[model samples]
Target: MQTAKRLFFSLDRQTECVADYIEPDRYSFLEQLPENERYIPRGAGLSYVAASFGSKSISLGLSKFNRILAFEPSGEEPTIVVEAGISLHKLHLFLCPQGLRVPVEPGHPQISIGGCIAFNVFGKNQFREGFFESCVEEIELFHPQKGLLTCSRNENTTLFELTIGGMGLTGVIVKAKLRLKRIPSPWLNVQKIPFTDLHHMFQVMKNESQTADSLHSFNDFTSFGKGLGRGFVYAAAFSEEDTAPELLMTFKSLERKPTRRFALFNRLTIPAFNAAYRTLNTRLKPYERMPFYRFNYPIAEMSFYFDWYGRKGFVERQMLVPEAKLDPYIEKFEALLRKYRPQIVFGSCKFFSGKQCHLRFAGTGIVISMEVMPNAANQGFHDALDELNVHMGAIDNIAKDSRVTKDLIASEYPEYGKFRDLLAEYDPHRQLASALSDKLCL
Candidate 1:
């Protein structure tokens, strides 16, 4: 391990930080850090905001501690115990041959399992499977002052809940026991349905959630006037048959290309891209069988997609609106998009259900996610978004960037104070801190 001065940025490339970095290969090495030294545990840094940013502490990188500690794929209840640093892609690769896989499919395959738990990530299948914490059976954390501890649903229940969506402020997660699912084949029976407006799209999504194992809508944020909110709703379920002629056993190798730093994402380019995507998808048959990897991790295929955001980068604002109030919220959202015409690089809609963890970003509602390119004249856009959140009683996803304040969290989440108390009790000295924790007063 070595200390180096460098800048760290999230996927949106919005939040940047300069700090000391260290990579500890073993749990003992992490535990040996100076007792008084402030540090923040980091996984794949998949959180698209300041959640993983450490401005005033050592950024402890856990990438080197990747290892699968235990595996039992032949039993009725298959389970895998893996080091926190292992990527979702690597984990899936190890289990695919055994006809087993993790249930929660977060968008990015590069994200670490530890980060997924910390963020309590929700995916297209959230409406059916709930958040990432739903699959977690147990977690092992190493605290600066409290030493190592193991928590599960049956024992240390409170700690298990706290660490699932704690954002790594509680401690460094070293290992996790995850429940796995068995599949007959490594392919998905995919279907793409077209919708003309946001209302129809949401209606179909709500209905499809009951039948589709995984579903998400690709929104046309660049469209306006007659074409506003026109997009496709993609849904999928595992194939029962063993035949998988189109199954890609491994992800295609991404070619290294020079970054297009000066590229501009505007109304013209975005609309054109959307039209092309829609046209190409519309010609395809209604149902097709594709590899599970392609269906679950589509973003990984476009390795250089972030280059379109340019140097200034972008910010994603994701809000969870209850199904009862979705209509009004979508009305306001459409108006905001029309008025500001922000350069939205990507956008999607997904349904969620069940009770959410203390700090997790899920509920029985619909989650609308949009990546907007920041501009000087978009203050009104921010204001409208904040107003929409309040009007719809929505909760901001901590994993995404937004204008969230301490008061908002207190008002929206009634258990915020209790969560704070737990944090204080677990780490009394407040040894684990990050820019996000300090900013939100956690």
Candidate 2:
């Protein structure tokens, strides 16, 4: 009875779209409703830019579909069956104690299992492993046309391939059987490396990635021209709990920080923090103790990091350039940055081995993502970046914008047209999207 139109909120209110929230436990309620052909189910609504968006009838929030459902504790498979709406944070808890981990997790734990699969997400270990889709054992797809169907690598191989990173366009991922990674312990042994400049940072990452079990960088290109590549790299690997395990905090204990406290003060913190933050040398810094949850995506602390960008909303531009172009791309991007002085506030480079993901963005190359805080002062600079396709020209690469217009977006990822075609065939009526979906032609 609760329709998405009655209770909806767009991820970015500036965009015109309303999601119909639905609890995972209420399956019967949805089944009873008139089936919508174009409806796309979404979780978390954390897809800041709109990757999981729909045009006509958006399937609302499904994060409550959070049941452990089934798991093979000692079975030969070593896998777990979970409802798609579970958060990555919760999923990690179930796996950690058994010396297991997720093969792919985005930069933040706030994302849901369904979101990860829809994006066919990737992570720090991508250089060696590849996208998150490789580890998924199977998925239960819900489509109005097909009704309820099973899709997996072994069974619905074509659909399975298309679903992973297909951006939820193929079908609604109701449940998934994900293969878990065995580990020695839930703890992580991580090292923080702060570079004084861009060259030093790139030089170190290329070298360390060869051995670091998993690596991620927290870098700033904001000063690229004025020497802004100075930043830190946090590389971590699963280790036998070397540190005291008391640092781990449970979900019930974790709470959202007060954003209101920083509202008036962030104007000063942005520049001041970056100044001191850029000067510190990371090499001299040694390894430190860290919890697995904290180590992977620590930025969870600054929840409002993106929203802090005032009126001129910021866009996160991400791409994967061949390793050989790592330094070249940095040089070229920085050159463009210096020319534009656009805010490259926060960025990261995670190594990956090449492979075609369903939506196809992360791959065997250098994966760089930046938080672009554009304003009246930086519009010209940001516009230049929107026009720069140099990386695609120099290397086998692609760029993705969760909020980008359909025309510009499809142009960036040629395979997107193919992706849309698959989506159309699967859901012919188009009852599952929001306004953004219609505008993007997805």
Candidate 3:
């Protein structure tokens, strides 16, 4: 076991802190930490919020435990057992050779499997495939008092439900048995369709969501009047033809790029970037073929985009607005943007189809993600966004933005109180916790 003071950064680069960090090389060393002390398990530590560390809590690093324990390929649906600390990138590489993989995955390649379960992450085709919970068959969790427990839909059901999106408050995730599906191909035929407005884009998105293998839209928010919400929807499906193995880029773990001393995205540069990006995409062929992994995880090659936000970092807020309420929500959203003119550097939309559950981001609606520089002048804009989202009955993603208040989350998610009560019932002492849990009182 190694103990030291380590500085950890949130994925957005907004928060950084020095925490007592512990890395145990073996299972026996995991017992060294005082059973009663509070600590949060750390995987890749890529959460946008301060989820893995706190000022007073110990951060238990699980990187050393990353490994594929077993694989069963004989069944109609094969399953793989992997340690919690394995990165999705590494897992994909292992599954690729066997023509098997998980269906739902968040964009980043560096995110850990344990983190995916803890957050109940969604993917490009979330509307069709469902959340990360749909991919998990069983979980092995460890709590100081409860010892080790096996949880699934049929066993320790409540803990299974809670631990899926429980934000690591339930206990330490040791490993999991994840259900897998066969990969149709190692490549995707991506079709890019440009739209003149948000409505037009969403219309195409809605239609494509029904048949496309994966779908998402990008919008240009730099201009308002005629140009507002103009962007492209990139819909992709697995290709029927296979490319030579040597032609594809090798799958590897991604590294976080160092941020610049000063922010590159601001009022002056954001508009230029948006225009150039739209132009570049428009000039490309309408349909293109590429490695499936590249489309699923563009961030693997674009990590420097986050680094451009610099030391002060940026704020990313993602929210889900019901399709029925989308018109008014967009009207309200545009009005807020026109009124405040927050320099929205990037905007994207995706379709989600799932019932609301325990603070998880899953829902039946259109999910929108906006990234903005966290400048002093933009504080009011962020606050107005909070109000607008609540007024429009949109559920703001709690994991994406650390600034979301407990009141805001409570007001939006009907099950917020139930989650709190359940957590209290399970861990009255709250032995497993983090800065995020502390803030939300979870």
Candidate 4:
């Protein structure tokens, strides 16, 4: 047990203070904090690098607070009130049966609703459904000072908007009432399309989602740009009619291991994975009736999947580029990846046009994500990445440097400062401010 009532650091990914605890237990812990004491809320510990690290404050771990509080029937927009600590994966189990779902889900479901709401998470579906925030009708907050505050789209509208993508700086999200979608039996009618490179591929995707379901695309560094690293695409839509439940599968015998070790932090093995994946996937064009979870989050064992990068301590870099600049940016991005050749284990890219979030990262554009070993002597490549990030055509730099400059935030998010101001009204004493809140410059 960490034996001090003082600063107890917790972290995830790689950092000094990786927190542990789910939402249920975390709720209990927060209610017991030293009165008026400063604390940061954390869930799943899946912030990629160090989103939850904090000093001079209690690290409120909400891992155990997870629970499907209440879920209603699907006749009139099935809805559920969930503990903030509940993982999105578990949430799916509750809704999948009714063919209902939260409109927006990130690539992986291990992320907690507390985190997702704070980040105002969006997905390929956003071209249609918007973001995870859109699925949320209301949220309940627990403040160190205030006992409990109920906020909803209709009641406390400002609180609701600020809490979305607010990064837990506003208050501890104890519970949330999220709207669920009616589906055709928890199956995704999926399609896989290949592009010579980024150009034709991205174009087709944007057009498809304009009138279709969710979509996500990725560039195989081993297949496109002077290499075999072309692009692989996955587009999915819910079925119109109910389908039979998928036979429950098991990973224990499936053998979906990533790899034992890295030969070097270069691009050799990655390209091979890309080639093999593309070959097998090419045969899967217009695949149909897949389990929704499989289609949404490829890594079904999300808890275990997150740990895969840890065997070697990895980091992910994500960038949101506006639609107009996506083509030119892809040209440069592909060249940069080829030249650097960092051992990118896996990655996914997708688009979104969500409700404007103060300091929120997504906005009617493309978000590219890549996982890599942080200390693989890849500084030269990392430097190039930094340069590209600095000059990416239309991306709001607020997403990249939210920690450094508040001005950049006002520039990109436009309303971020207002969000912070509202946050101040809710938490004037700065009791809920977190390392992420500080970094997001909110």
Candidate 5:
């Protein structure tokens, strides 16, 4: 075990924690270190929330445990076993060469398989493919008291469900075996359609999500008046036709870019930037072909977008609201956005469909993700958003927001008590802990 004193910050840079960071390269070493200590397993450390570190806990990083342990591509459904530390980008590169890919993927390629499983992250086509839990075949978890437990649907079923999206509170994820789907090619046929208003955007999203392999939409956050929600819907599907080899290459830098000194996405520049972005993209070609990697990891090409937020960082409030309550909810949301005008810099919408699990952020609803710079106005807007979320019966993504309070979580998640009970039953002593777990009193 290589140990050091490290200071870790959330992806948003809003929270910082100091811990004894330990990197374990071997399975035995990882298993033995968790005895009678507060520790959290950390993957790529890309979580927007502080789900991996705490002031009193040991931050056990698994970066050195990354390795492809097994592969079996013979059957109708191929499967690959990989250490939890493998990054999505590395896994994609390995699978693309063999004509296979993970159906559901998070936008950031730097995220780890362990992080995806722990957070139960969804991709563009979540309305179709569901979340990362669907792709997991088996998990090897290490609990200090339980030793090493192999969890799957047919074995240790309860433990399996709890660990999938347990927010690293269940135990340390050692390795995972994932199911993969065959791909026709490593290329994609993408189409962008512009919408006139919020309702129009919703209609377009509903129509396109039915047939598109992957679907997502971008909105003009600065246009709170007449142009509210005016933007474009991006629909993509795999294409057999070949594309340029360079476009398929994986991103070179896995580390996050350093934040700039001053924020470029302030109230003044955001409106102008949003207007120019909307006009430019609306005028571009309606149809285009690009590498699948490019479509999956759009932020990789524009790493500066996050850096532009600067040292003040940003706050992203992502919530899932049912379709039945969407119109009224969005009506309230629009009013709030207007009242909080120019504070929002980025906005997006995604479709989701699945049964709601214990605290997992998946269901039949429309997910709205809005990014805003931190300030007096933005903070007030956030507090109002919190009340609005509960009043509208929305599920605020626990993994996305760092400032979510215990009261908000208890009121929002209907299955909160059940999740807490199950976690307590599994971890009677409450051996695992993180800033998030403590904040929510999990």
Candidate 6:
């Protein structure tokens, strides 16, 4: 019912568009659309690239569809049926009161559940519980051509898999039934382990995988030469008896601030900052218990974390390499980091297991994610990344990929052609499309 110019931009503030129309409504929103008009569904707009941007078509905004249709707190198989527009943070608040929680906790808490499913997002504990899709019991999708269709493992199996990591290209996800886990307390028993090098870190990660419920490692990318791979590894699990007094303490959310036009992170600033950060970590206690929000969603607490990248913003590059190739691949990757010396603001390491969906970014390997600030002078950084992808046989995470080509995707994801065929069958007329789909020729 609203008529206004809609400007869509990615999280990194790199790609943007001014769309003709943006309709925000209930399930019937698709019915009013004009025939043969292309549109892309939007959630929290968390994709690092232009996946949800519609330059020449309508951008279907689903924020108004926020509603919880059903809630089952106590049962053998507890579940919650929620509208796609509901943010994960809201859902967490709702579930925490009932002593239940969703296992998959992506870093961004404000992201909508629909966006999480579209990306099949990975969590800190992906090494144990798998991607967010693993918690999905069923979904309700509205196809422009086919109308409403319910999909799950028991029915419409193919659509279920496709929609899980389909990047909203398959259809408009209206509702979803997510499985929930019962927790004794909303806190985590955290253990901070520091490592001097890549080999030591990987060894610790492998050893901790068997006992830890969640694991994530921070790398000091600014460090060069002998101190190259020095950083901290965090292993944590939900507290059972509220035994740690530190975990009971509440921490206020950090103040929100507007992004400044000036740059906060440059080549010189990053090295010095990282050096200090590493030193500060060394002074902290090896073990500490903190609230669940502090351990799982720390970045969410800092509302202005992304603003540090400045107005030019940054691109997030993520790739997954098999476990067998982890050692050598990381060694060479470190060399590339030294050669390019791109201004890296944030970096993390995670382990992933279980079978990967056709389009989902999951596998039995290690995932390396880095946020880099690029300028006109850093053209070689892009080339070096492309070469590294080829050399390491890395799989491109569709959500974070900006420079990946169709050929590179085909070379890396062999199941991509089959996924395309399935998408064609479901949306034969191509009623659903996005900038990402068009860029990778999906």
TM-scores of the candidates in the order shown: 0.94, 0.86, 0.96, 0.83, 0.96, 0.93
Give the deviation of candidate 1 from the true structure as CA RMSD.
2.4
Predictions in order: lDDT: 0.80, 0.64, 0.84, 0.65, 0.85, 0.79
Model 4, which residues run further than 4 Å from truth? Answer: 1-12, 18-32, 227-229, 249-265, 284-288, 302-312, 338-342, 375-377, 380-421, 439-442
Per-residue lDDT tens digits of candidate 2, residues 1-442?
5554533323332333444544445666556546644566777766654555444564656776888888876755578899899888888867776667777777677778888887667777777567778778889987655666788867988888887766666667888898877767657777787676666776777788877777877676644445576677777777764534434544321222223232222344655656655455344445766677776766656655544654344556676666666666667677777877665566676667775543566545666777665446666755565555533532222223444666565655657687778767766665566554566686
lDDT of 5 by residue, 1-442 (tens): 5668888888787888678898888877865674778888899988988999998889889888789999998799899999999998889888887888888899988889999999999999898889999999999998878889999999999999999899888888888999999988888888888998767888998998877888888888786778887889888887866733535455544344445578877667988887887777668667878778888898776666777878778888899988889888878888888887737788889988898879999889889888878776677688888999898889899999878888899999998989999999888888899999998999
How much is the lDDT of residue 396 in candidate 4? Answer: 40
lDDT of 4 at 442: 51
Candidate RMSDs in order: 2.4, 3.6, 1.7, 4.5, 1.7, 2.8
- Name the regions of candidate 2 deviating beyond 4 angstroms: 4-16, 52-55, 75-77, 224-226, 241-246, 250-268, 278-285, 304-307, 310-313, 390-403
Worst 10 residues of 2 by lDDT: 253-262
What is candidate 1's lDDT per residue for 161-261, written digit by digit as tens?
99988988888999999999988788888888899888998888977877888898888778668778788889888788754543454543232223448
Candidate 3 C-alpha lDDT tens digits along 8-49: 777777667788899877766665667778889988888889
Candidate 2: residue 315 lDDT (0-100): 58
True lDDT of residue 216, candidate 5: 87
Cα lDDT tens digits, model 4, 1-442, are 2414332222123334323322235455556656756667777655643445465456677777788888886567778899898887788777776667787887567778988887777766777888777788889988777767899878878878777777777778889898887776667777787776667677767778765687877666554335434666777777767487855532211112233553343455556766677778776543666777777776655445544444344655566777767777877777777777676766667766744556677666777766666664666776676666557643443322222334444545556667778877766787775565665555
Query: What TM value does model 4 have?
Result: 0.83
C-alpha-based local distance difference test score of model 2: 0.64
Cand. 3 Cα-lDDT: 0.84
Q: Candidate 6 has which clashing residue pairs, if any?
A: none
- Consecutive 10-residue window with the lowest summed lDDT within model 1: 251-260
